[model samples]
Target chain A: MYCVHTTALSHRFSASQQVLKEIELAVPTGSIYGFLGPNGAGKTTTLRLLLGLIKKQQGEILLFDQPLHLHRLQLLRQTGSMIEVPSLYGHLTAKENLLIWQKLYQCPKPHIAEALQIVGLADTGNKRVRQFSLGMKQRLSIATAILHQPALLILDEPTNGLDPYGIIEMRDLLKTLNTQHGITIVISSHLLAEIEKLVTHTGIISAGRIVFQGTLNELVSRQQSESQMILQTANNTEAAQIVKTFVSDVVINAQHISMPLLSKEKIAALHRALVQHKIDVYEMNAIKKELETIFMELINQTKHD
Target chain B: MTNSFTNCLSAEWIKKRRSFSSWLVVVGACFIPLILTIMFLVYPKQILDLHHSGQFWRILQLRSWETMSIILLPMGIVLAVSLITQIEFKNNMWKQLHTAPVPFSSIYFSKLVLILLMLAQLFVLFNIATYVSVWIPALLNRDVPFPLYAINGTDVLKENGAYFIASLPLISLQFAISLQFKNFLVPIGAGLVLVVGGIIAHSWKYVYMLPPAYTALHFGEASGSTKHTDHNLTLWALGYFVVFVIIGYLLYVNRKEKG
Candidate 1:
């Protein structure tokens, strides 16, 4: 079951400025869907729309198979979200802060302790939130959202402002939340490198549109399909003449031949042919770092088009 | 009440604890009474004639509400209501709240309910403090004679009820403004301006139309200093209260950018 589904969702802030074009999002159940986009890429706006925090100008949003606008309260009851900063009361202690949401959601008293323990703030009693570090505040925010034990969690830039240690802690907590608790998580960030490790599904947004959305493996495979390998030879000019017949789109460089990424069998056959033609193979290096390149390429394509 | 509303109220009360407005209510209600108690304690002879004239409670009501109705009550509501409503804005929790399972109406009305409850709380405390202020002096001084008259419950209830009703329009106005603006001072500044306008125009013929002037007008009539040109001014206050509340709720719920 899809935890969240949006179809043809679009929004505009003003007459001249359209924030989101026609966009669709499908976040599968029990998966951590990473919504990736640079700053002002409408990631927050889309999350806000999904949470029903922003009035939909033009769109259809569904949470847990229920229409968002028609069943917002019901959907929201099963969803937890943290947008921008955690928005905690500075004067209230972590436990006290939890009590506020505890009353709102009508959760049992023990759930407060359970949530505080989950966030690793179990011992922060009588200590106001103002004194807590940024990472601690974010965790408390997650606890507040999960106090009701919602099925879906939507967090916008959950790791936006954290140190390396804090980022790792947040990632681990989210992983546990998704794995052990069976919660569907949609976490958005500008850096793919930040959430790439944690998200089971990825949705790359650019210019208020979904440029890429699929499983992480699919993204990797997409990158692989577009990847190429470089072959360095003792006599590259002669290898190019021999290589042009086997591999399509082979471009000869100063001392190497760049060709489409071939299968292992194809590469082995090509290597045997190069050897038979008396071209000494000096080195063969498959191009790495293709994922980031594809991400940039997708975003830049939208920018130019 | 539904569990959702009850939960909202409970949550609001928890958030209100230890907040500055909590202190404001206690101190705002007790400040004049405490000073009055000290004055009566220090100068027992100050009220010797009023006690003999059997106007002690009446004078106490007048004295208690004179500053209160003219400035303190209106301004306190302005500040206290804004403080309560601004909790979400100051903490940047509106987005967090808007995403919760409970309806937006629950959140909006719960905060309004809290503001009203606090105002009622202030009224009750101020009345109790007023009685305590007088009793302390009567007990401390033998000459004051306990005023020879039982406390006139009707007159006391009448005054408190009128002031409380008169305060409704102003309180709702403040709530509506506070929800729109994130800054604490805008509602307060507008409240201060309107209150000053009301006090200056307390004697004007059309003061009945001005909700901020209702408190002052009630004071003027209750003290017999001026006849209420319109007895339905309290009704007018109630009318304005309903209108402002409806407007505030609509503005809050209909916002394209809620959080």
Candidate 2:
């Protein structure tokens, strides 16, 4: 079952300006779904809509097989979210801030300490939130969200403003939350590279619309199909002529012929043809496309279309 | 749901206790009584004129209520409401709080109830401080007649109770505005303008319809033969309180936080 599903979701700030347009999301249960988009591309807006923080202008949102608007309180009871910058009471201590949500959620008192420990903030005793570092505040925010052991966790840009180590720690914590606790996490990030290693599935959004949504392996396979193979030969012109028959869109330079890496068999055929043609191949390299590149290509395609 | 409301109230109390603004509002409430105490101590002859045949308790109550109604109570409500709502706004915690399992009504209701409770506490404290201000001087100076027994305790409680009831409309109005505006100064500036404008418009027949002017009108009755008993004004205040609360809740439910 999908942890969250939205169909025909749209939002507008004004008559002429549309913020989100017909956005659809399918986040599977027990999987870490990364909501990726450029800045101001409505990732946070989509998250807000899913969390019922903002009223939907036009959409059907389902959370845990229940309509979100009809059962917001009941649905939200099993969900936890931290949107944008971690919203914390500055005057209260980190533990005090968590206690507020703990009481609100009716979580046990020991859960606070457990959450603090999970976030690596267990040692921050009696420290006011205002005095904490940005990363520390982010962890505390995550702790508050996870304190009740919700089934679904929605975090928008959870690693935003974190140091490298902080990002790694957050990634690990999210993984543990998903793996050990069986929580479905929907995290959003502007950078695909930031959450690529952590998310099992992804929904790439551009211009308020989802351009791609599927498992990470599907995205990787798609990227692989668009990958390039570089062949450096003693005679580039002859190698290009022999390679063009096997691979379309082959480009020739002074000593190299480049073409799309269609398949391993095609590369082997090109190698045999190059050898038969007496073209001395010095090096052959396959450069797989990065997820970030695929993300940019998807967004750019939306812009042009 | 009952548990949620209780939890919300407890959370609000914790936030209020840790907040400096809460202490600021408490200090704001004590200002008029403190000034009155000083006035009585320094200018006893000028303030306590037994020769004029006025009851000391009556004069003390009048002076305290007059000062509080004129500027202190309205300003205190404005500041207190702003401070209470600022706890959420300053931290940008509304979105987080809204997305929590608890009902938005519980959050808003608990906050409004807490603000009212704070205002009530201040009213009681002001009355005690004002009484002490009079009793202390009378105790120190044997010449001044202390009308401790002569003063009707029930009348004092009734008058102060009336003042608190009359101020509810203003509190509700300010609380609504404070919740709508995230900036602390905007609500405060609007509140100041309302108070000044209400006082100036008090001569108009419909001026009593204004929330800030309700305090002045209710206390204005105290100087006359009515003696702090304005059932119509209290009813109107209650009506205004309900209307403002509904409006505030509606605005809160519909408001979109800036991303």
Candidate 3:
């Protein structure tokens, strides 16, 4: 079952600025869905709509197969969310804060310890949240979200403003929550590489639109279709003529030949043809593109469209 | 549903521990009584005069409520309600609160109930402190006789009930304003300016037109043609309280983006 499903969900802050267009998102159960976008890409807006924080302007939001407007409280009871910077009362201690939420959630007391321990805040005694470092506060925020052991957890920019170690800890915590505890997660981030490893599914949003949504492998396959390969050989002049027969967009440079990435079998076939023609194959390397480049390319492609 | 409301109220109660409104109630209640005790100590003639006059309760009422009914109590309500409502905005907790598994009405009424309870508690404590103010003077000075007149429990209850009822409109008005504004000063500053205006206009022929004037008008400390009108001011205050609360609830619940 899909944990979250939105059909043609659109929102506009005002008549002039439509922050979210007609968007559809389906996050599978028990999967870490990374909502990838840049700043002002409508990721937070979508998450807020899913959590019923903002009133829905148009379209429908279904959480766990229940309409959000009809079953908001019921769905929210099962779904935990941290939108943007988690709002925490700085004056209260972590335990005191948890106790307040425990009363709200009406969960058993032991769950408080379980959540604290899950977030690595079990030992943070009596220190007011105002005294906590940013990392500690972030973790405590997560603990608040997880206190009732929700079936689905939605976090917006969970790793923003964190050190490397803190980011790693957050990633590991989310991973444990997903795999070990069997919870579904939908996490939003501006950087693709930030959550690329932890996310099993990714939805790349650009300019308030979903540019791509699929598994990580499908995303890589998309990048591979547009990827470039470089060829080094003894005779570049002849290799260009031979490479032109195999791939259309062949560019011959000084001492090397460049062409669109081919399938493994095609590359092998090209190697055989080049060797049979007496053009010694020296080396082959596919040009590596940073994940950020792929992210930008997706966004720019949307703009072009 | 009742359990959810209780939980909401419990959460609100926990939040007040860090709010200044928690202490403002106590301090506001004791302030006048503290000064009265000191006054009776420094100048013993006032209590002695009251003892000779035989109407100690009436004199105490005038002295105790002279500034309170028009100024401090109304302004205290404004600040206390403002502080209580602004806690969520100041700490950015409204977004979290709005996302909780409860209805908007639950959050709205839970806060209103807490503020009303605090106001009621303040009145109860102030009433106790008013009696203590006289006791402290009696304990300190042997010459100053303790109030010997039979304490008319009904009269005291009626007077306090009147004052509390009179303050309702002010409380509801401030709550409505606090719920709408995110800035701390907007509600309190508006309340401060309005209290001053209410005090200045408390004697106006049409004082009933102003909601803030209800508290002062209900006191009727000065004997005038207005004393007859004071009887109906609490009724009007209750009416205004209901009206303002409805408006506040509508504004709060209909808000597009609550957080």
Candidate 4:
């Protein structure tokens, strides 16, 4: 089932400043979809539009096959969100805030204590939120969003301002919600490592457009290996001139010279040529791309385009 | 529909009751009449008449609803104004309520109703002060009217209940002013200015535009005009109330959740 869907959803601040260009995105039911983008790339704006926190300029947003804004209350009853900042009242204790919100939503009363335990905030329930550390505040925020047992949880930078242990705890909570409770999660973050752990699906947005959207494996498979030989030499300048005689698209850097080899036979011939040229080789290993590096590389490619 | 309306109201009440601002309003609302009564009871006769040379006994005698509607009514207005506008200016609680499943009218009307209740409490305190003042004089074997001169229960209630009825629009005018502002000071400051401005406008004949002070001033003049067509004043107060309620509603409904 399509748990979340947007069709040609376009929102512009004004005629001059377009925040979200025409874009279609989908996150299937029970899938943990990670939204990756740079700051000011309209990630939060898109989340707001999705949750009906703001008006959509054009197109439609649907949650569980219902229009978000038209049935916002019904939609919101089953969907929880923490838009930009966790805006729980600072003066109210964690339990007091939960009690007031529970009265507002009239959610099942028995689950409030359980929800607090889920986020590991049950012990701090009576302490005022203002006294909470940043990590505790973030945990309490998650507890609030999911207290009603929403099927879909939209969190924007849920791990922001968290220490390492707090981030780990948050990650575990997200995974548990998705895997055990069947809660679909849409999380937006700039850190690839953060998303790489939990997201089964990924959407990379740049300049208010989705540059890439697919499963992680599909993205990995799309990366083609460059037929390039990296050479380490005492003198890269001489080595580059010699490699230029045999190959094209030569790339030179401080300690290494790289150029595309015509074939496997040419790689052996180049090795012989480099050794014959009296250039000492420290290392000559092929580069394997990680997701973080690949993410930056793809983002840079889009920037140039 | 009534159930839902009351449910929303109760929710708003529960949320705001725990808020510090509501505590401030409650304390401030009760304090005004308490302070005024204490001043009347203890202070030397001359201190009560700071602006005039009236006898202290007369000043204490006049501390009824009529006196409060003239001098201390501004305190009620200030309290109402802050209670309404400060909800928006101080915190994110407005955003929380706005995004809830409740109807916009419920939220708006509940707040309006709460402000009116606060004003009602002030009115009741003034009544109590008046009762005690009159009771003390009678106990001392002095000349005072029997059955303490309560403004709403006395001359005003007998005259077709025009005094309480007329004050409806007066309260409505301040409600509008409070809704229009996001800053807590704007409504209080503006209400004070209108109160002073209304007194000045009374001499200009076109004082209909100012209603906070002038709307309830009809008691001073005899109600002998048979037709009783104070259309201009009624229109001014009602028109301000209607225009403001609409503007406030539209501003609230159209506001983005982020704001």
Candidate 5:
């Protein structure tokens, strides 16, 4: 079953400027779905629409098989959301803040200690929130969201101001929350590298539209442009010509001539021909794929579309 | 609804207790009455005949409570307004309340009650100050005759109690205004201006609704006369309150969440 589903969701800021146009989104149950987009690409807007924070100009949203607008309050009880900066009273302590949230939610079990512990703020309960660091504030926010152990957690840029250690800790906490507690997470962020490691599935958005939505493996496999390869040889021009027969797109600008291979067998045949031609091959290797590159490619494709 | 209301009340109280503004309000509440008492003693107002104990008590009733309301009462209102509304505006606290499994009425009303409680605190402190200024000097064998007047066993309680009750409509109106503008200075400044304006407007008989200043103009009148004006008091205040509250709630319900 889909945890959150949005269809033809359209919203406009004023009568003239359109924010989101015919945006469709779906998140399957028990999947850590990463909503990736650059700044102002409508990631947060989409999340807000799904959660019913703002009224949609057009379309329908369903969460847990119920219409979001009709069942917002009921649906909110089963979902936890941390959007933008965590809003907390600076005067109150961490425990006090959590207690306020507990009262608001009226959760049967307060989970004050456990939630604090999850965020590693258990020892700092008595200290006022004003004294806490930015990373600590983000963690406390996470704790507030999951205090009731909701089935789905929606976090928008949860690791914004964290140092390396803080980022690692947040990553580990999210992993534990997903793996141990079996809570589905829908996180939206611009950090491709961070999302690449944590999310099981991703939806890349640009200009208020979903450019790509699939698993990371599928993302890497769908690159029909070329498998960027670097062949090191003494007779670079000769090897480039030989590779051109096996690979359709070949470029020989320098010593390292790059080509797109149709298959491994074709590359092997090219290698045999190179050896027979006495073209001393120094190195041949495929470039390692990175999500950043994939993201740029997808965004470029969307811009063209 | 009841549970959520209580929870929201407790949450607001907790926030208010820890707030610097709350402390400032309590300090201001205490300071305003104390300063007025000192000014009266040093300047020596012949506004009322202090020779008679009854007249002396009336002076305290008329002067201290009235003076405090001019600036201090409105200051208290501004404090309550700022403390309640600024939290949501400055941070994303509204989001927490927005998504919570509670009705909007609970969140809105709790803050309203807290503002009322703050006003109540100010009035209580004013009464205590009246007792000290009037009764304490009389006990110390000062020339003043019965500094604190006891009118048939109940003195300030009977007189000021009516005015306090009349001020409830003002409390609701000020709270509505405070919620409308999250800024502390705006409500505080506006309230101070209104109090001053109300005093100036009192000479004109048509100026009916401005309770704090008008109540000051006719401080110690017969029950029948006070009762006649009570209609003016209740109608105008309630009218302002209903309009303010309805407008405030509509604005609240229609407001969109900010990041």
Candidate 6:
């Protein structure tokens, strides 16, 4: 069953500016769904709508088979969220802040301790939140989100403003929440590399629309079809002529010739042609596009269209 | 549902604990009495003259009530409500609180109830301090007869009770404004301007329509020349409280958190 599903979701702040347009999302249960978008791409807007933080102007949203608009509080009871910055009372201690949520959720008192331990903040004793470093506050927010033992966790840029170690810790914490706790997570991030390692499902949004949404492996496999073979030769002009006969759409620069990888045998045939032409081939390798590259290509393609 | 309400209140109480702004209300409540004590100490002859006329408590009540109703109470309401609502705005806690499992009604009303309780505490503190202000001078000046009979406890309670009721409309109005604006100074500045305008325009009959002016109108009723109680002003205060509270709750529940 899908944890979250939105159909033809669109939002506009004003008559002149449309933030989200015909956005659709399907997050499978027990999968870490990465809501990927650049800044100002309506990823935050969509997340807000999902959590009922913003009013949905148009569309249908279903969370756990129940309509979100109809069952917002019921659905929210099973979902925990941290939007943008960690919403913490600076004057209160980390433990005090957790206690507030603990009371609101009516969870057992010990769950607060458990959550703090999970976020590695169990030792943050009596330290006011304002005194905490940004990473500490982020962890405290995650602890608050999970203290209720939610089935779905919605985190917006959870690793933002974290150091390298903090990012690694956040990634591991999210993975543990999904795999160990059996919690579904929908995390949004602008940095593809930050999310690529953790996310199993991805929905790439551009200009307030979902440009791509599927499993990470599905995305990689789809982009793999466009993988290119790079050939570095001693003689570039002769190499281009020799490789053009065997491969269509051969692209050559000053140092190398590049073309789509059509088949495994095509490389062998091209090598034989280059040897016969005395155009010495120095290197030949297939370069599969990375997720970051694919994300940029998708955004750029949307812009051009 | 009752459990949820209690839990919500407990959460709000936790947020308010150790909060500098909440303590500011206590400080503000005591400020007028401190000023009154200093006035009695510095201007003994002036106080003695009122005592000679056998109207010391009446004059003290008038002075204290005027200062509180015209100046301190309205400004205190502005500051207290601003601080209470600013907790959420300053920390950007509105979205987090709204998205939580707690109902929006609980969130909104819990804050409203907390502000009311804080204001009530301030009223009680201010009254106690006023009595202490009088007691200090009486103890120090052995020769000057203590006007114990003049400072009737029931009268003080009645006056303060009236002041509290009169201030409710302003509290509700300011609470809404504070929640609407994120900047600390915006709601405060607007409140101060309205208060000054309310005081200056209190002579006009239509000025009673202004919620902040209800304090000034209550002060008018307390002065001996006017009747001790004005039923019309009381009804207006109640009307404004109900209307503003409903409006405020609706606005808060409908408020969108873009971040």
**Highest-TM-score candidate:** 1
Clashing residue pairs found in predicted model 3 = none
- Candidate 2 residues lying further than 4 Å off, grouped into runs, are A235-255, A262-278, B43-56, B135-151, B225-231, B256-259
Instruction: List, for all models, the DockQ compared with the true complex.
Output: 0.82, 0.59, 0.74, 0.28, 0.52, 0.64
- Arrange candidates by lDDT, highest first: which order? 1, 3, 6, 2, 5, 4
Candidate 3 vs. true structure, TM-score? 0.95
Q: What local lDDT score does residue B72 receive in model 2, on the 0 to 100 scale?
A: 76
Order the candidates by TM-score, highest first.
Answer: 1, 3, 2, 6, 5, 4
In the range B1-259, model 3's lDDT, one tens digit per residue, is 8889999999889888866889998999999999989998999998889788777887787678777886888888888999998888888888888878988888989999999999888988888888899888899999998787788888778888888888888888889999988999899899888788888887677777788877777766442225634446767889999999999999999988867
lDDT tens digits by residue: candidate 5, A69-127: 78777888898888888878888899888888887777854498889988899999478
TM-score of each: 0.96, 0.91, 0.95, 0.77, 0.86, 0.89
The sequence of per-residue lDDT tens digits that candidate 2 reaches over residues B87-203 is 888898988988888888899899988987887788777777777777766777766667544769899889878888888988889988988887899999999998898888877
For residue B239, model 6's alpha carbon misses the true position, in angstroms, by 1.0
lDDT of 3 at B33: 93
What are the chain A TM-scores for all the models, listed individually? 0.96, 0.93, 0.94, 0.81, 0.90, 0.90
For model 1, how does the per-residue alpha-carbon lDDT over A6-42 read when each residue is reduced to its tens digit?
A: 9999999899999899899999999999999888989
lDDT of 2 at B128: 77
lDDT of 1: 0.88
Clashing residue pairs in all predictions, respectively, total: 0, 0, 0, 0, 3, 0
Off by over 4 Å in 3: A241-249, A262-277, A280-283, B148-150, B221-231
Q: What lDDT would candidate 4 get against the real structure?
A: 0.67
lDDT of 4 by residue, B1-259 (tens): 4544676666556556556546554554445455654564465342324224333333343433344455455555656555655655564456445455566777777776765565555445444554454444335443332333224446423332333344455566566666656777787787777677765655554554556554345534332222223554445556766676676667666766534
Candidate 3's residue-wise lDDT over A1-305, tens digit each?
88899999999999999989988999999999999998998998899889887899999999998999999889889888788886888888899888888888889999989999989899989788989998998999999999988999999998999999999999999999999989999999999889998999999999999998989888887778778999999999988889988888998889789898988998999999999999988988788666678889999988788
Error of 5 at A116 (Å): 0.7
lDDT of 2 at B42: 78
lDDT: worst 10-residue window of model 5 chain B = B220-229
Q: Write the per-residue lDDT of candidate 4 for residues A192-271, one digit (tens) a residue.
A: 89878889988888778778888877666554243346788888898888788787788999878876535667767877
Q: In CAPRI terms, where does candidate 4 land?
A: acceptable
